[model samples]
Target: MSRVVATTTLWRPTGPEELALVEASGWAAWPPRLPEQPIFYPVLNEDYAIRIARDWNVPASGVGYVTRFEVEADYLARYPVQQAGGRTILELWVPAEDLQEFNQHIVGPIEVVHEFRPQA
Candidate 1:
């Protein structure tokens, strides 16, 4: 018999460059963080993801994308949820060193759910 695993949905706001790398991974994993980046933050709510993609990413990179994926709930329990700002701005901070293991816990393909681009 097969066992069912519990999963938690998470969203990440990313720019064109990072999205490209994600696609290059066949949508199965997130790219490794740059040396200066110490934490990989995946937000818990879509609204916050959307806001960051539209407001922060677009302005910085000319385009922004929101990707959603599910991770094993049990694996994710190791990290505490952090409040970045208001109550709804919740996120999970995965240390950069743990990203590889974190990626392994993803339940399925990472999907691009929304896109933002600068207005002409």
Candidate 2:
């Protein structure tokens, strides 16, 4: 039987220092293999989301596919500005079959974001 695995991450614009740090780290670039993009949403906090993405080795674009689960109303109140901007909670659906493989390899969501190019 297939089970749904939720991978999450926080995606905000990278600051200058963070960008520089990434460049200085000299990490190797990897080809995208995941069938879907990474998904970001309100249901998962930045910490949890980041953890899941790394665990799954999801690409930046693929991260868009992560779905929001168990989001609360009070959480919405915290983001009044986003609501004013008409930004609803974003969610992505990944096939349950893919979850196991991702969980096995990805240590966290930051690792997933690391795979994505800044411009791409």
Candidate 3:
């Protein structure tokens, strides 16, 4: 089955380091696995992104970034969304090994939507 992805999709609340890689690589992928980061997470909505940026990243790292991009939505159907921590936060978790396939699914370049940096 084909899923028609909207003209745009949302990826969000990225830390500065990760954001740099995404900007450089041209697509978002799962970061290297550590005990802390076991999966690659890409968010699917703005509300969730905002929550992460404001409530999580800013408090934790003092900065967050949201990126917008066009992906082959049909390919996204292969992955399942995981909801945790609370409602309103929905994201896809791509396993580390499967990340290549995930990256392949992205249709084009990624663009930054908003940068959340708290003034010190």
Top candidate (lDDT): 1
Residue 79 in candidate 2 has what lDDT? 32
lDDT of 3 by residue, 76-105 (tens): 777777886677678888777777776666
Model 1 vs. true fold: TM: 0.97
TM-score per prediction, in order, is 0.97, 0.21, 0.76
How good is model 3 by TM-score? 0.76
Question: Which RMSD does model 1 reach against the true structure?
Answer: 0.7
| Sliding window of 10 residues with minimal summed lDDT for model 1 | 16-25
lDDT of 3: 0.71
What C-alpha lDDT do the candidate models reach, one value each? 0.96, 0.33, 0.71
**Which structure is stronger by TM-score: 2 or 3?**
3
- Kindly report which residue stretches of model 1 are placed more than 4 angstroms away from their true locations once superposed: none
The 10-residue segment with the lowest total lDDT in model 2: 63-72
What does candidate 2's lDDT look like per residue over 10-103, in tens digits? 2332323333443453422112224453422222244444444444424433432222223223333333333212233333332345433323
**Cα lDDT tens digits for candidate 1, 30-87:** 9899999999999999999999999999999999999999999999999999999999
